[model samples]
Target chain A: MIELNHVTKTYPGASQPAVDSVSLTIPEGEICVFIGPSGCGKTTLMRLTNRLIPITSGSISVDGKDIMGLDPIELRRHIGYAIQQVGLFPHMTVRDNIATVPKLLGWARTKIDARVDELLTLVNLEPGTFRDRYPRQLSGGQAQRVGVARAMAADPPIMLMDEPFGAIDPINREVLQDEFLRIQDKLKKTIIFVTHDINEAIKMGQRIALLKEGRLIQTGLPDELLNRPADEFVKSFVGADRVLKRLNLLKVRDAMMTNPVHCRSEDSSEKVLEQMVKNDLAFLIVTDRDQRLLGYVNQYDLRGHKGHAGDVARKLTLTVSPERNLKEALSQMLSYDLGILVVVGEDGRIQGVLNSTTLCSLVGSTYDEHGGHWGRITAAGRIL
Target chain B: MTTYDFIVRNWPELMSLAWQHTVFVSIALAIAIATGVPLGVYLTFNRRLADTVLYLAGIMMTVPSVALFGLMIPVLSVFGHGIGTVPAVIALVLYSQLPILRSTYAAIRSVDPAIIEAGLGIGMTRAQVLFKVQIPMSLGVIFSGVRVAVVMSIGIGAIAAYIGAGGLGQYIFNGITQTYDAMINAGAVAVSAMAILADFMFGRLERTLVSKGLRRD
Candidate 1:
């Protein structure tokens, strides 16, 4: 864990501190995102943790040891750091950049070579394709990946990332974020991430610490801040879409209804229609014996049918994975004008169903769980 | 007599003068690089002295080379090193500093701050950052500076013959006094050939020495 106790940093001649007396703790294996407007000292706070800039007062400790007592060079080698610029050395090949810390630690030639290849694989870059290529040869997204790979060169237990994906295009940023999250799950390195983007904080952070004018305003889980902002500053910072943003943190499985009324593909159309009628439903899902989704049969399609339900079943063009976020599912539903969506597992087996009503109730219950009194009052007001 | 005949007749003498010329410029350029590069690097750390020192080197360059050689004669006489090769070399060394120093200073300063920050952030000590990051990145620019100095020194070294330093310049000065057009032609042609050769060699050296990562082509 990295702990900051009343840590403050005042520039030599500045009137106020860049990072005021802020106290926070980033527990091990969690990404604590520091987010605020520019000049809010979010970046300064990250620098202080690595001793990139000296603190004016207070103390910082890493894993129960004071960082000040450790040699800065020794400290840095053990703590990986990546920045917005992706400041890759232009003179070195990608392999060399990633090998920097290992070489510094005096690892043998074969070991460093293997480590470089291993890290390249971890970052999804082919060693044969990228090892000899220079930084200039890479696109912005690739360079950032290499930058991240280089930081993790020595497998440091902690990492400081300042908007690592900030320079990437939106589509690419989401991809890198998901891939990084997948990697973080496996590595479980303690991380302190900095970004001015709230959406990124929601997506990347396990806990979000919001800052304002060099002071810590609130630090909590992403859902916590979205459901209950500490003040107007944070509310506005999280934007008016907090309700929708909160959905991004939830998976389709979290709100899915299990044991949905579905008919096997070989079932008679009459039998399928009877089942749909029994459930008071307008449509019936057709599945194989293994419960794999084949399609759906609607009442209109079954009106004059006298064959197997599979004969008239139309393919469900839009389907979401159980692991996908609700926000994506919501958008998928809206774009397709779907009132209901089928959730499937990796093998295409129908796991459950998510409908609009169930999604809304999940949102409303999330509001209630977080003591979102205003949200509930508004919901009640709307109902009335 | 034809210039070719003049060259063949005086081939041994010409080779000796050419060898002497190469030695004088090579030694002077070596001294200049040894002193100037360090000064330029130091100024990067001490910005207060940079403008003053660079301005001084710039002023030193404005003085005509022939006049600088004359000025060096009396100054060095005080140190018991008056005239000839010593004075010629002293003048050449001073003349060479501007390009070498300015290039080193500019190259080092132009290195991206982000790259330096990355180096330090990655746990390299200050010296390691300078030697490994700063120096390697600045090399192409620094070498270009050295190239300019080399070409400039070759041209200036010829004028050193006015102070009794032997070179192809010996042929030109002797030809001027004796009114021998062939000797002057031979001297002028040989000196121009030497300068071109030096420039081409340095170009090849730059390709060999500079990091392939830095090359555009």
Candidate 2:
């Protein structure tokens, strides 16, 4: 665990302290994100944890020991540090760069080489192809991956990341974020992530600490901050579209309706149409005996057909995994003009159905419980 | 006689002078590199001191080769080593300092700050960062500086012959007084050829010394 007790930093000759007295505890195996606008001391606060910037007053303890008591070099070696610039050594090959800390600690040559290959594979870069390549040979995304690998070389229990994905293009940034999260899931390293982007904070952070003007204004889970903002500043910072943002935090399984009305594809069209009518639905999901989604049968297609439901069922081109966030499911639905998406399990079995109504109600109910103007807006939409 | 014919006829004489010239420049370069490179690196951490030292080196470079060689003789006469290889070497070493020191300082300074920060952040000591990171990264640039010093030293070493230091410059001084066009041509040609050869060899050395990753090609 990392704990801060009234930590503050005032640079030499600076009139105001860059980081004001702020105390927070980040539990082991959790990601605590430091987020704020530019020059808000979010970066400074992270630097203090690693002693990259010495604290002017107060104390920071890592793993229950006062960091000031530890040699700064020894302390830093045990903490992984990654930055937006992706500071890779140009003169060294990827293997050498990643081996830096291990070599410093005098690891056996064979062990360092093995660890280098292992790290490259972990970041999804093929070890054989990238091991001997230099940083100059890597693309921006590849370089950032190498930077991350180098930071994690020694397998430091705690990592300090300052906008690790900030330099990548939006498309690749999301990929790196997901990849990092996947690695973090298995490693469960205590991480302090710093970013200025709020959407990233919600996605990567298990808990977010909001800062403004060098002082932490509020800290809580993404849902807590979105649902119950501490004050007007936080409410505005979280933005007006926070309701939509909250969908990013929820999984498809959370909003999907289970036991959706479905019929076997081998059933007669008349039978499928009867099922749709009896359920008061215009469309019926068609599935095989294995419970795998084959397609859907609509009233228009079913009325004129006189064969097995499978023959007339329109092919289901879109399906979502239960593990994907509701935001992604929502986008797929909106982009394809889909009213409902089949939630499929790993075995290709149809586990549930997520419709626009269920998704809206899921978000709407949360807003209603919070007693906000958004709840009234969603309610009026129900009339339409 | 044509320069080529003169070179062939006095090949033995020219070869000896060329060897002497190479020796004088080589000794001077070794000393300059040893002292100048470290001083250049040290100056990076002390900007105020770097300014004063680089300025003095620059002023030394502006001194004419012959005049500087002349000054070296007087200064070294007190040590009973006037008008020979020692004074010539002292003058050449002084002349080579500016390029070697300036390039070393600039090369190290030009290294990406982010790379250095990454090194330190990863728990390297300041000295380790300099040796393992800054120095290796700056090798290409520093070599170019050494290359410049080499070409300059060769040219100036020829002038050292005027102060009685034996080299290809002797032919030029003798040929000018004797009005022997063939002798002067041989000396000038050999000196220019030597400079070009040194440059080419150093270029090859740089490619071998610097990491392939840092090479632009």
Candidate 3:
């Protein structure tokens, strides 16, 4: 565990402390994100942990030892550090870069080589293809991966990252965030991550510590901060789309209605119409014998049809998978004017259906889960 | 006599003078590199001192080679080693300083601050970062500077013959005194060949020394 007790940092000749008297504990095997706007001391806090910048007052203890007493060089070698710019040594090949810490520790050549290959593979790069290549040869995303690999080269138990994916484009950023989360699930290394992006904090951090002007505003799970922001600054910082962002963390299956009203492809049109009316539905999904979604038929499409629903069923080319986030499902529904989206499993079998109402209700309950104002949302739900 | 006939008749003397010229330039360049590189590296950490030192070196470079040589003769005369190799060498070393020093300083400064931070962040000591990271990356630029100094030194060493320091410059100065054009051409051709040869060799050395990732060609 890393604990900071009333830590403060004031640069030379500076009136205001960059990091104020902030006290926090980052439990081992958990990712604690420091998130705030520019000049909020989020980066300064991480630098303080590694003693990159000396603290003006208070104490920091890493793994139960006062870090101030420890040699900064020795402390840093044992803690992984990655940053926004990546800061890769351009003159060194990818392999040598990853082997930096190990080589610094005087690891044998063969051991360093093996560690390099293992780290490259861990970051999902083909060691054979990328090991000899320089940082300049790698793409932005690839270089970020290598930066991650280099940080983990010595398998340090605590990793400090400051917007490691901040420089990447959005699409690649999401991919890398997911990839990093997947790796973290297995490594379970204690991490202190810093970023200005709340969305990224929500997606990547298990717990977030929000700061403004060097003061710790609040520290809790992403939902806690979202549902109950400490102040107006946080609420505005999270933005007006806070509910929409909450939906991003929720999966399609979480909000999807299983055992939805669906009709077999060969079901008679009259029988489907009766089922739809009984269930107060305007349309029914038509599927094949294996429960694979073929299409759907609305009341208008069924009018004057004398055969089975499949005969008049329009192909629902747009479908969502159960693994997709609710935000993606909602956007698809909105873009396609879809009232409900058929959720397909990996095997192409219909698992459930997602409607906007159900998704909204799911998002509403999240407020309730975090002890926020759920009554207002419930009233809104009823009005909707 | 024709230039070719003069070369054949006095080939032994020409070879000896050329050897002396090589010796003078080699010693001056060696001393210049030894002194200039350290000074440059030191100055990188002290900007105020760097400005004064670099300015002095730049001013030294603007002094005409012949005039600097004349200045050195008088200065060395006080030390009782006047009008020979000592004055010539002192002039060459001073002349070579600006390029060597400037190149070293620029190369070291050109290294990315991010790379240095990464090095420090990853637990490299200051010395480790300097030797293992900064110096290696800046070597290509430093070598280019060394190449410039060497070529320039060879040309200037020929002029040192005026102060009675023996070299290919003796033929040029001697020929001018004797009003012999062939002798002057022979000396000029040999000096130019030596300079070109030094440049080519250093170019190859740079390619071998600099990391492949940093090489543009």
Query: Each prediction's Cα lDDT score?
Result: 0.88, 0.90, 0.88
Regions of candidate 2 where Cα sits further than 4 Å from its true position:
A258-320, A336-353, A365-384
Structure candidate 3, residue pairs in collision: none
- Model 1 clash pairs are none
Deviation from native of the Cα of residue B102 in model 2, angstroms: 0.8
- List model 3 lDDT by residue over B1-217, tens digit each: 8999999999999999999999989999999999999888888999999999999999998998889888877778888987999889889999899999999999999898878888889899999999989998999989988999999999999889989898999999999999999999999999999999999999998888888878664
Model 2, residue B23: C-alpha shift (Å): 1.9
Per-residue lDDT, model 3, residue B4, is: 93
Per-prediction fnat: 0.69, 0.78, 0.67
Q: Each candidate: how many clashes?
A: 0, 0, 0
- Off by more than 4 A, model 3: A257-279, A283-321, A342-353, A364-367, A370-384
Error of 1 at A356 (Å): 1.7
lDDT of 3 by residue, A1-384 (tens): 899999999989989999999999999999999999999999999999998889999999999999989999999999999999999988899988999999999999999999999888888899999999998899999999999999999999999998999999999998999899989999999999999999999999889999999899999999777778888988898888887888888889887777666788788887777666655667778888888889888888877678898899988888899999888889999999987788999898888778766777677744354323312212111000
Local accuracy of candidate 2 as per-residue lDDT tens digits, A167-235: 999999999999999999999999999999999999999999999988999999998888788999999
Candidate 3 chain B: worst-modelled 10 consecutive residues by lDDT: B208-217
Q: In candidate 3, how many Å is residue A268 off?
A: 12
Span of 10 residues, lowest total lDDT, candidate 2 chain A: A375-384
> Candidate 2 residues B103-173, lDDT tens each?
99999999889888888888888899999999999999999999999999998899999888999999999
Instruction: Give the candidate number with the greatest TM-score.
Output: 1
